[model samples]
Target chain A: MILEYKFEYLSNNNTLVNFLTNIADASDMKFEITKEKNEINFYVDADEEAMSSFASTIASDLPMSVFLQNTAVSLVQEMPPSNIQADKTKQFNLPFCPKCLQKAESAESSDYYNPFTTCPMCCDTKDIKEFIVSFGDEIKRTDAYKEVFEDLASRIHQGLGVRFKTLSGTFIFEKLENLQEDKNQKDIKLLCTNLANISNVVVAKKAEIVALACIEKPQMDFRINELYKSKNIIQAKRLSVRYPNDLILYLLSKELRALGIDFLSYKNEGSYDINVDFENFDAKESLKIPKLKILEQNRALVLESENYDKKFMQVFESLKEKNKAHFMVLLYENSLLQKRILNFYTSSRDDDNVSYYAKDLEGFLDVLNYRLPKSIQEVFEDIQKEESGERLLKNYKNKYPDSIKTALEFDLSVLKNASIVSFWKIAESILGFKNSILDNASLSLLEKGPRIDYKLFESARIYNKEFNYIKLIQSGMSFRLAGVDERTISLGYIESYAHFISNIADEVNKEMELEGISLSGDIFADERISHYVHKSIGKNFKIFYNKDFVIQTRF
Target chain B: MNILILGIGNILFQDEGIGAHFVHYMDEKYEYISQKNSVTIVDGGTLAQRLIPLIVRYDYLIVVDCIEAYDSEPGDVYFFDFENAPDEINWQGSAHEVEMLQTLNMIRMNGDLPPSRVLGVIPKRIDDDTAFELSEEIIAAADTMEQTVIKHLESLDVSLRERNPQITISAMAQISFKREIVNDSGI
Candidate 1:
């Protein structure tokens, strides 16, 4: 039996596309949806069976926080004991004002719903619950979701034209324990499909979901010829259906076609595939990678590095397609070299509402951290100001007096020398550098026999860990003079390192607050401000204003 | 809970002795375990059977061994928890009876078994008869085994008794592609 029910609703503002997608995914069985404008119309077909089960499933996985009386009850109010002889022998309680027992009033229905706050003048349970506006910080963390869900449930019972199927006229019901166990999406979908298959009732996630129907699942399920496909499917030139696997048949077919694979047809209702020719395709064959590779297109080249012109260019030949955006390139921001490009690119495209998110660790930090690196530098500055730093520097100079002395101290001159760069590269590494950003970097640490020649601080992890990373950022070469080849040299290695000089220069974005300096609200919010300030100070000091992301605008 | 790790290796031959060498460090000075932390450490001494009880009792059983998977780096770490299996198409049988890929295949796809991992550190050679005569270069990577374990455990929302780890975030791939990558990359 087929039954039709419809209702009008004003689309609420807060519903996002994701919410809609979730609803569609959950209600994938029985009801078919056709969207025109913002309105969704559902067409359902099933015997007057399984309606209650369907309703319970929808009620359970509503993405809501609470349950209301209406969600479980019917719009048709239970008749108040019509045939019963009135309870004339009712016991009496303390006398109360006649007005206190007044039925629900509707002067302003939505706003007057608090049971406890019933006006001393009149009592009402008919009104919808008023919005609880004073939900504090705790609610932001949770709570408010519960209230909304409850409200929607209650609204359902308040006579909203709800339809109930007749199956010997017995209403099916469910318990909460069973619903609570349906936690994950998979389980929820199963429950909804299961419930709708047995119980003949309908349910809605929102008060707005008007048209709901439940159908039965035939044991043999041979109603296939009766079903028709939506026209939208036939009109589709492109459709994006995201699955857990990237090995999509449609995408594979397109790729196969591009490689000149021949004549294809639907193999079976289950599955089919065509073998692709990987030989010619690997050689960057006739197929050209598009500028902005369309989603689900044959192939897309993702930009992983921001230095699109140089370092990326060096490795471009390695990529199958030399020139193309493919789908999109995910760029890392930490590379001082790439930051240079982004610095220019951001300013140039600022007018186009261009937002660049660096895919690299350093780039991600520089953009997201707001002020971490700078704070690290500030901490360094604080440490430097301590009387102990002078003693440490003086002691090293006295001990070495020459090469060893210069290298022992954090000196730019000594750090720049190849010998020190090589030596400290090993020293700093041995001390601790393996797990940093430098882990992915390409650099060598040189050791000079048993005397501890230097450390090469090759990995990006160097800056994140080493206590003296800020000191090295000031005059990277001088770090070698400190007798430790402990300094970041790779343009992509340090988040704060910039390229202002002939080579990639160090730049620290030190974020901090000195004893007397004024600060912004963020400084008080967390220690993050100080850390970022230190790195900012370190990067800012090192920047010669050459790289775009680092010193994108100025020197 | 304190995590006790037993790394058995011989980096001398390339990748064979790495497990033993790694255990040497993990049981000795690896910051994750020995870093003045509440964690305990043990050295399996390239002796798998001897450490069976210890491996089974520990919250996690991490085996750092040289799995002959063709061309892999001296210290490249292959992480596989028996609970999460690789795809069947790629999971050709491995030499060991308790093949990590195979075990994981059973657990993840078929939903059988529990949690444990058999890390296959691809080495240059397995020595004459899986002897622990690691080269100086391969021996140098003993520290990485500890790092790999730390990274993997952290992904499960766990922290060692001491020592914070460095985390690297990667982009999310589609599930099927993810499965392929996990299999290939772990292999």
Candidate 2:
């Protein structure tokens, strides 16, 4: 097995260099330093026994060192069983490991320390020597002779590993084989800057290259990663731990893919990892199944995660009114409260039209395999229930709250006694106008003292706000005429209000145009009628106002 | 050379009305400058579209307005060749109009838009007040801007000769005609 370790120390401090130097001077072990200023890498060659001992000593001692900031230790390649002349020379002696002796005596013990016997006690192993020398020959034994070794060597024998600093924080690992498999699970990959030294390429036989690749690409392939590198690794790690579920979502996507299930994975699609077709097992033929949409939601690890009720409701409401499916499958990890939430939502809805499957990955896969009912339509009797026109309009309004004009029309259509004032009030609410738009336009006309109400000249008009005074008067008169006789509401005021409304609407349209919002047909039609009415009623005000066509003032 | 002085700004915003006020001030005190057959002073007044034809027609155009071009003292005056002005010109248009840059670009798209110089003053206050009067800093900047505009006119070989007593105020006023008609049909 090949052993690789990366230990990072502050460049300003020479403690790491001094420590490695001291070890090399004290032993016959030859180590090469690939030093680039602050970073000093040690590449040592030794027999299996010596390497294991050295690895164990370093793994136990280095992690606690103030100067040893970070270290990656991996066994590059397993030494051929009998290649070492020293090991072959000692083959005749009993390979005595006191730890293996005690371990074999336990009920869990699979094997005792013997050259020929594979030790089940040390760890499930084919060879007794492989058990004692797993990490690095670091474990101490009460043998007659005192022999010291590094724990990292035995750990490497157990698995290929890496230790490195990432933007997210220190990524310490004991194994890195399934990384290539994990990378293939998602289309998105992390771009680790410092980890560039380790590439994603999987090479064979060359332990050095493999070790380097493992170090550089751990971020790309591991569950322990982040969206972007933090300037301070420590802070990033602390923050990352807070939202570990977000980190898990990235991993869960891979886990789901590993299950070999056919599902469409959508990135951040309404806070879910995937949308699986429960009824249709085949990708090509899944669309044929009329009702098979299942959103797979993954909850974060925190005690209180984002509420899915509102978000799920909004999503269910916006489903292209034509979509056949409406169901959610929530995947939770170690969350006991999630079951209660699922139950709460399931029982809260009046119709209970939505089917839900909530559980952890293992439980979810079990449900997917043995429990899920086929054809969601069979599960939901109200699948074909058509929404009323008013309900549809309400849903539309909910979806587009910024569309105030449409909402106003919807409100007016539903009102019991919709008067002109009510209509204007609706319009004002939609336009975000605080004061009555009609009143402001009309009162602005009274700015010039005691002017003839009909011939409201420019000097008499107030220009404080954007409104046409004449159209306001016309709208006011039209409102009065709805209830009062024309004998009371003079034609001049009516004409003035008509023009005012027309001018204000046109101005509003122009303003909306600048903002790149094309007004809907209903709003456009309302404004257009005002403009056309004013245009057709030209000069008729003179006949009505001069005679005082005397009517009572509604105000 | 037919020289046109176009002032542009939205009067709804207090100090933004500086351009409109400058044009009106020039119309009163420097109407004498119009004695030169080629000189025309226009109050563009929040209407970027209104200045398009005049911009393309004039041989030389000088624009006056409140500009937030650089981080400087509020009343600092800046005069520069409009063609060489920074692309990051801080001129926001009113809700009903295109920006000044867009209007100028439209003219250039049609053909050449005459040699132009933009005389700008950084305003101290641009509060959301629909008042006609300018702040004191703006008023002071306007005085300095007047001198700079005079210098620019001199460089263009145009001088503000004293008005002939014979030239009636109405005649001088006629040159200030608003191209866009106001629809006050009832009056």
Question: In model 2 chain B, which range of ten residues has the least summed lDDT?
Answer: B178-187
DockQ, candidate 1, comes to 0.01
**Consecutive 10-residue window with the lowest summed lDDT within model 2 chain A:** A542-551
The digit string of per-residue lDDT tens for model 2 on A202-274 reads 1112232222122111111122223222322111111111111111122222232333211111121122111
Docking class of 2: incorrect
| Candidate 2 local lDDT, B1-187, one digit each (tens) | 6777777765434566566556655655553333443677766665564456447777888888777754567777788887788665565434322477778878878777888888877766643222344567776787688788878777666676543324322232222222221111111
Interface RMSD of each: 21.1, 16.3
- For model 1, how does the per-residue alpha-carbon lDDT over A1-555 read when each residue is reduced to its tens digit? 332222221121122222223333455534433333323333344445554554454444333211111212223212221111212232111111122212112235432222222322111212322223212232221223234334322332231211111111111212111222222222111112221122211111221111111010101101111111132211211111111011112222223334332112121122111111111112211111111111111111111112123443333334342111110121221222333221111111111111122234342121111011223224334435643344433443454355333223433333322221232242343233333223222222311101111112234531222223333432222222323333233222232221111011121212221111111111111122222323333333321111111111111
Say which docking band candidate 1 falls in. incorrect
- Which candidate tops DockQ? 2
In order, candidate lDDTs are 0.27, 0.35
Query: Compared with the true structure, what per-residue lDDT tens digits does model 1 show for residues B82-131?
Result: 44533322333223323433433443464332356656555554313212
Stretches > 4 Å off in candidate 1:
A1-555, B2-4, B9-14, B31-38, B70-74, B85-114, B126-133, B136-144, B153-187
Backbone collision count in every prediction?
127, 52
